[model samples]
Target: MNGDWLLLGRDGRLSVYLPSDGAALWRAERAPAGPWEAPRRIGGDQELLPGLSIGRGPDGYGHLVAWRPVGTDRSDLVHTTHFRPLLAPLDWQPAGHPNKQGARTGTPAVAVDAQGRAHVFVRNGGGGMSMVAQKEKGGWEPWRDLKGRGVQEEPAAVTGESGRVELYAAVTGGIRHWRQEQPGARPVPGEGVDAAVRPGTLRALATSEESTTVLFTDDDSGELCAWRPGEKPMPLVAAAGPGPVSAVRCVIDGHDCTLVAQRSTSGRVAFAAYPSQQEALGAVWTESGPELPADAVVSLALDADGRLVAATLSPSTGQLRLARRKDEPGLALGPWQAV
Candidate 1:
């Protein structure tokens, strides 16, 4: 599962972080439809774990957080950032403590708040939630646990419409959540909903200041479900395989909509667009492009030009394949091409 592998930087460029022997970056200038630049590997010989969690603020600063292997089984949560004048040197720093505590951290889910501070959440070694954030002045706060049991890996964290940071994770029987009452406030436990959430598939899309819609697959049935605060769980289409889905909120033909991409039954990328937060109105799934490898994971994001971009990372070649929404009516995408 991707913890937000692709992101749109402030300079109107879209960058995808690849977990190779080290952290690598591929930048496309004038994105949505881009002129892709050569891939540049960042960092020294530090070998990062597979997932890269990316977060950016309105001011355009971007941060990447991931687990870098320490000893045999432990890892250090390293965070790196990029701002203006793109040619600056990159620094990877271990947040909180190192592996000295014998903690084996998982991939982190990160989000930048209104103040441009990166908030990172990861499943701790004790099967609970542990988090670290960038202090307002500078530097990171201590790693603290947001108590919960049986928390899954790769929680979905996002800045809400009001700038408050919120998070959702797939827990034992359903999904659990945490949110800040206001911007820059510490996140406390929020109301959690009971649904059959597939671990690593719990994704939250913040539609308003007070609530976020969470989407996930049923662990037992493989069907999709959407859970909104104070609303009953709504059932969606079935996913042909067992991977996470990518969702982005954008305007289509002047109507607010949410675009979702998942693995089709035929092991290809499929897309669907529906009224945002109006799941009961129904959505129709359409498969796009030729078949991808059965294990390929797909994700979606809005490019700098406000175009909906759907992407899948090739498992065999490690190349990122991308397609953007067509300018015509309905849910259509241009030809899939490698970046």
Candidate 2:
């Protein structure tokens, strides 16, 4: 469910207005950052994947970053810094880290570690290569290109049960795993990259202190899939076609909650909920009303207290709606507001 009324504009601008007084709070430009002052237009035919994603860290800080367009060759990477509210106007700075060989590096994924430092993993388009970069002390570390094969993309990270940060990346063939190097420790391989799973996009859900689950659609059949920490990746639910999956989050505040918002082939936004991650992949799932969007860029987030918030482009009127999860049935959208 939406907390405040947000107006999602058709021009790709999200105007988050205050619900109480209908005053705009923040308006973020959905554009690509480049060479200090240059503003490059992102997300088009040249750029297969849009160069932006937003996430709130565990410490309640908003993190945002963008990947410089590598054209079709996937080289020439210029990843931006993980910006927070503290550095106004100059919130996003250059990461100051790049591949030594510079084999056309881009498609960087950012995850905040338990200590508040950001961990970025970039994939090389030349030979399905991967590299890990971390911010430490007062500067960013040199890129550590791990030896591996497969088109590594969509890296996901979380502080594991042991407090050590763990990272997962989707491989062209399957999935690869990595952790902060400890002397001579080696990286591991995750489950096979199910051909059914889509490339470059996977939504991860932290189920428990000991387990993490990732959700994606099968590349072949477009069926939904769920992969737990140590379990084999398998089919979760079946879908019509392979459309982008909108942010999947598990809202657990002493209450069992799981919600995944995805778009169907018809351009309608759908929501799926479960008692837990277990139930979501099981035989049953509770879904919300269809929010048909014309442009199809949707995002969802859940508060620490289990309140569901979704933002999407409405297909009918081209408005951005910030809807919340109504405990009842039949589109009882309170907080039924626009941005």
How do the residues 235-265 of candidate 1 rate in per-residue lDDT, one tens digit apiece?
Answer: 7777656777788888998898888888776
Task: Give all candidates' CA lDDT scores.
Answer: 0.75, 0.48
Candidate 1 stretches with Cα past 4 Å from truth are 22-24, 30-32, 84-89, 97-100
lDDT, model 1: 0.75
Clashes of 2: 21
Task: Give the per-residue lDDT of model 2 (tens digit) for 1-339.
Answer: 111112222232323321111111233434311011112222222222244434334454444444433435333333333232222222334453345443334445555565655555566545444544445564566656565566554556554433345566676656656664342232344444444457655666566666666666767766777777556776756753355555444544444656666655665566655555564445333344454654445666543334556766543344555566676543234453554
Model 2 worst lDDT window (10 residues): 16-25
